[model samples]
Target: MMTSSIVQRVSECFIKPLHPIEDSKQISYLTGWDIAMSSMHYIQKGLLFKKPTTSPNNQQDFIESLLKKLKYSLSHALFHFYPLSGRLVTHKTQHPPSYTIFVDCSNNNPGARFIYATADVTISDILSPVDVPPIVESFFDLNKAINHDGHTMPLLSIQVTELVDGVFIGCSLNHCIGDGTSFWNFFNIWSEIFQSQSCENENDVPISRLPFHYRWFLQGYGPPISLPFKHHEEFISRYESPNFRDRFFHFTPESIVKLKAKANKEFNTTKISSFQALSAHVWRCVTRARGLTNDQKTSCKLAINNRLRLEPPLPQEYFGNTVDVVSAEMTVDELLQNNLGWAAWKVNVAVVNHDDKQVRKMLKEWLESPVVYQLGRHFDPQSITVSSSPRFNMYGNEFGMGKAMAVLSGYANKFDGNVSSYQGYEHGSIDLALTLTPNAMRALELDEQFVNIVV
Candidate 1:
């Protein structure tokens, strides 16, 4: 939806690591986890910042200075997150006619991208809307770019858009390279390095967490896991459903506590986490707003982190995707008739039960017959995928000038029943971006039960 008429692209360049890895260490293999996200579109999201008022210079000077700081800090970030600078390439063999997908991190590989642009929009335009403005998608150019396009496209791209009175630092990262965890890790590091620019000693800001590059693989599986699908089109869903709408809703800390307490009290246990309780509430409210009958079926595909679910737990700093999509299913009556605790318990059981053994079993099964997460393939009108967690540090990213004003995502990989949660601008607050049918959106906006707690 972005065009040159609306957002002007001033300049663009590829950014590489300041200290490159040797060509041998550059070719990072696609782990089973990474491969699972290979065909998925680049994750599109970014932070919004108020324009710096301290700058005494004109707009041109401010733009140049800001770009310099961003490029410098990003270079340091790339030194550690070098995979972001590499490209994904495919190898075709003649004898067997098989193809292999890998990251081309050789010296000849093209680096990541940094684009500087000026927009005629404002922060209010993005933040004040009940529904995110469609023009916000223009903040980044990777609107429809999938990870497979990494062969030709930059695996990672950062687009800095200078708005009338604000700035938007948008990033488009190939999903195959990492998940939301990895993306934020890289982003926070970049901000840290950026903030340290004004310090007396740049070395004072040491890299707090070094990422673990080892990809996850089943113990018995080959290093090169053979995927069941041959071509990208096999599982990619091209049919875009019309009449869908997206809405932004927020839940404050007090509301979160209340939701969790109510859930635990009803269950007569303290096992239900705040996230589970909140998710269950959202699922119930969304289902009811859809005007579905009591007998209609519904499902919630909740994505869980597997960093600590392995036999030998992965480090907190482990990079790449270890997401496990746990599916919770029930009839409309079961979900709506029951209390919030009942629905939450259903989700909690699925999550607490996915321990080491369960994760290993899922990994082994995937290795045996790999199934790539098809683009918009998980179809069920009543099913919603709740992804991106409140645990992700979304609001604390500070770069000296000030903290982020808000968080916004671009139009990529979004479909009906897709929900993404982000930490709000304040602590203990969560913002949910829900995509639903246009009619459902209208109902949800008017649904008193759903609107009462929304901040």
Candidate 2:
């Protein structure tokens, strides 16, 4: 078992852009969907890299070198994703009541929070084969800057922690600024710069993909709707309670393939992908562990990337929130009484229903009635929200050291019935980070079907 007292913060400061934004007067307006997401908490993600053995013998010098390279690369990367260095602002006195907000891409707001820290832990402390590590949360900054008071918080914040045998990069980003896809895009680009160790010239950098900041692509068919503050309060209160426990489960390639084969055989259909099959399996196990009534309604919510689902396809580098939740609901008995293929089919259907027309309709509806419709809002003890994509090149994020030892979600422990998946370091395997009530987690641990598949 890993110890709790592991990480310690050495310094914290705001990292401004290395170069000033030339167009200080330019503003990027938030679409109705962005405005609806402004009140949500920042997404906290961490990548842990094992210490490189090639570093000089001196410990302090090695630490300094790592920080310098990281900061330099991050500042240079901000030039391409400029809006991330900006702040969210509102014009409350405007005629339409200014419920809408925009990103101020001015030179004055050209900074992101950076933190330096150390940990008395090792890669083995986190990557235990049979036990979940307690130090997972300690490897990240707990005090993330959520946009609670409008423009009070920065759009992005980063924390770098040095461990006994590894380094951890913790990133906290405002949800209104971008979704997971955009965040990973920025991460991959930053990694490219760090690995290359030269950010001097934009032309020679070889960073081919540039972010598309034009928010007009999300424009819907109707005028923006105004939601009451009470509704926001109610929505936030539902999922923010401090009554959850987070754990990670590993599924090897063999197990995943076996599950997929089983699911396909039961349905006599070969359409279910690995993700759909795994999600269905997890949803069933979680529902069974919760021990809800047979008639209780439970939903599996998945965030679908709308960038490609849109009619004309948004730019691959579009740097803003462009995702919508697609869910499939079934009663507790209906889920438990069925086979894995039954649930997998439902999950597959949910994803297939989110075509171009459905995405457009979702945007139009949100524009017409602007209310916070996050997957979190649909979550309860009986429901699960699955975020993160297994397709992201998380293991490839080599920032001058080497490949990351592990990737973790810093905030998954805070909410119940939440599941995030990442591509495991091992080929064809997946890492599932799950949060649930203490009792429910215990029940899940004792579940034979679930335990058989998990490594």
Candidate 3:
């Protein structure tokens, strides 16, 4: 059952760029990375901030002013990340019933949707529970929105929920626009602008870095190739997540160091990374929790950043998706029979071998005869794909308020097997969030092998 309390909407409006390009209309074609992600869920993340003052009087007035300051800063931020303000435009073809996708910045009024809402809860009301409270889901603006919804919906949406003692700034951006790197780029600038306004040296704060707008594609392949499928319906299916729950497991720095040391002890070569060690551990624990047979097949899907893998590497600030996922698979008998280093080595090989040559080959195959991805399309029960990176700077996004108390996500694109990882507030720590079936969740909570290392 859903929570009884719900957020009440106060007002809504769209915030356009403060400085728009004049005379010329801008258009950008969606790259292969963008096209594939365009069919997935919007990336939803939120920052929790404690109120600045302790006064109990005129609280609503304070919140009103804070909202005004945020929107103003957002408008300025949109000037640089203008593609996010533009909506996704599609061209329809009746003969074969297909559509071509692109972002159009020519609209008279293009902007991100800003929403304000209030909830009767406190910060403790959220962080006190072992599992994420359902009310936390209400803070996000785009509840069930997917990237394909960009055709008619706002490319970016912000929902600020006023709580009794704090504020939750939830954001939703189309995955097609960019990945985590791009998201943080815009957010960091927004905070810098906001903080400068409160200081006497307002003009002293300058944007640390500007984002590059070029999209990624294969070397020989041209841009914006059409999908072999006739309609988007064939590529996407309805998502039903009525029976899943989200849980966050915090892994401390000490545990990670131990895990890494244990993994490296095997194979006699200390090459396995911390990520590989932890991923392998999680894969083994989950496989056991699910109670599969010894012969059952299991697979793990992990995304490798291709920015550095290309012949001519892309800029660090390149503001588009340069991500591609690879699978590390094995049977349950082999996986469980092996030691920590063996499984970690398997993951390492998959990541290390996905070089420029291999990536180009895969890209060529997709372009020539597009593979209709079905088995792993919708939370394939046999596979697990880690969504976000632990390297992203999540704790540094301080928007005039103090550092974030915690980082949370909204209810978008969440299925039984989807996973998202975040950098913890403490150095060398990681926070892992997962959406799993009720049975699996209970089993995981009781599994001593996994719980011994978690904080």
Candidate 4:
């Protein structure tokens, strides 16, 4: 529902990269995990900030200075995360004839795209309520923000929107290159360089952890599996449901505590964590809202970060995708009829089952018969995909201006049954942003359990 009228002319658009890579044509093969994500849409992250109280004597000078710093620091950050300043290349001439993909990290390739534009909106326009603001989509250029063509779409695209009293920094990165952790790692480093005002001496900055880019670690004990293009096509078709809408729901600390206690009392068990309790409550409410048959099976799919769960933990900075999906399913009647604690227990069990051995087994199985997109087959109107983590310091990302007033998901085209979570602007609170079919969303808004917990 956003229109182009919201965004003014583009002030600038160009490619930014670190110092030229020595080899202009080096190729890096993607892991099975990366190939699986390649078919999905780009991951969009946005940070909004209020206008600085103190500025240069002139307005134009202030804007120019800010842009210069952003571009410079971003280029320097690319030095540490080099694969981002490249493109995804699909090989059509493999011996066995499969769509093999790899990262073309050559210096000659177009680096990350940087765009500057002006917007005729304010921070309040987008973040006034807990619900997702309509203008959120208008804050960035979606058409060019994510390159659909693997050959030409820059691996990363950054769009900065200058507003009357705020700024919106939007980043779109190919999911195949890295997951949310990798994206935020690059973002935090960029902010560090910008805040330090030391683009020239970026090397002098001490990095607590450096990214590990050798993806061979993900390979398991088996011949490489062939990932076919047809799989992605089928994956897309499965979730192409109609009348979906995106909305955000806020849960204050007090509500979360109360929900946890209530869930525990339901089954007389005290082990459910906040995440489990909350996810269970939401899953139950959503299923009820969808009006599924009692005998139908409903599932909740959670993306578990395997960084720490691996037997020998991956390097803190292993920069590629290290997430594995863990799902819990129950008949619609059981999910609806059970107490909150029963649902939470099911969720907890699903997570606990994903131990190191299970993680390795899953990876090995993926290697034997690789399917890039894993969620579509089990995904339906009765399913939910939960991503992002409240533990990530989304609000701490600060450029020279100040900390972000709000963090947003740039990829709002999320289908129904998709949920993303983040730390709330207010401490001790959690924000749950979800996309659901229009009727389901409307029913959820009126549901007593949801209304009681939502702020």
- Model 1 pairs in collision: none
Query: Which segments of model 4 are wrong by more than 4 Å?
Result: 1-4, 22-25, 54-57, 129-131, 141-148, 198-204, 216-242, 374-378
Residue 71's C-alpha lDDT in candidate 1? 82
Candidate 3 Cα errors over 4 Å, as ranges: 22-25, 94-98, 198-205, 371-378
lDDT-superior candidate, 2 or 4: 2
Compose the digit string of candidate 1's lDDT tens values, residues 224-325. 655555565664544344657887899999999999999999999999999899999989998988888888889888888899888689986787888888
- Clashing residue pairs, backbone N/CA/C < 3 A, model 4: 36-372
How much is 126 displaced in model 3, in angstroms?
Answer: 0.7
Which lDDT tens digits does candidate 4 get at residues 1-455? 23444676576565646577657436777776776674466778889988776554656777777888898888877877888888767655445556566788888777888888887776776776545765676555443232224567777778898887888898888777888888787787778777776545656455556778877445443123355543235333323335557767889999999989988888788888888899999999999889889999898889888888887788757888888889999899999888899999899899999988998888877776766563345457678878888877688778767778888875433767988988898888998988888788889989998898897
The TM-score values for the models, in the order shown, are 0.94, 0.90, 0.94, 0.90
Better of 1 and 4 by TM-score: 1
Per-residue lDDT, model 1, residue 430, is 91
Candidate 2's error at 371, in angstroms? 1.1
Which 10 consecutive positions of candidate 2 have the poorest summed lDDT? 222-231
In order, the Cα lDDT scores of the candidates are 0.82, 0.77, 0.80, 0.76
Q: By how many angstroms RMSD does model 2 differ from the true structure? A: 3.0
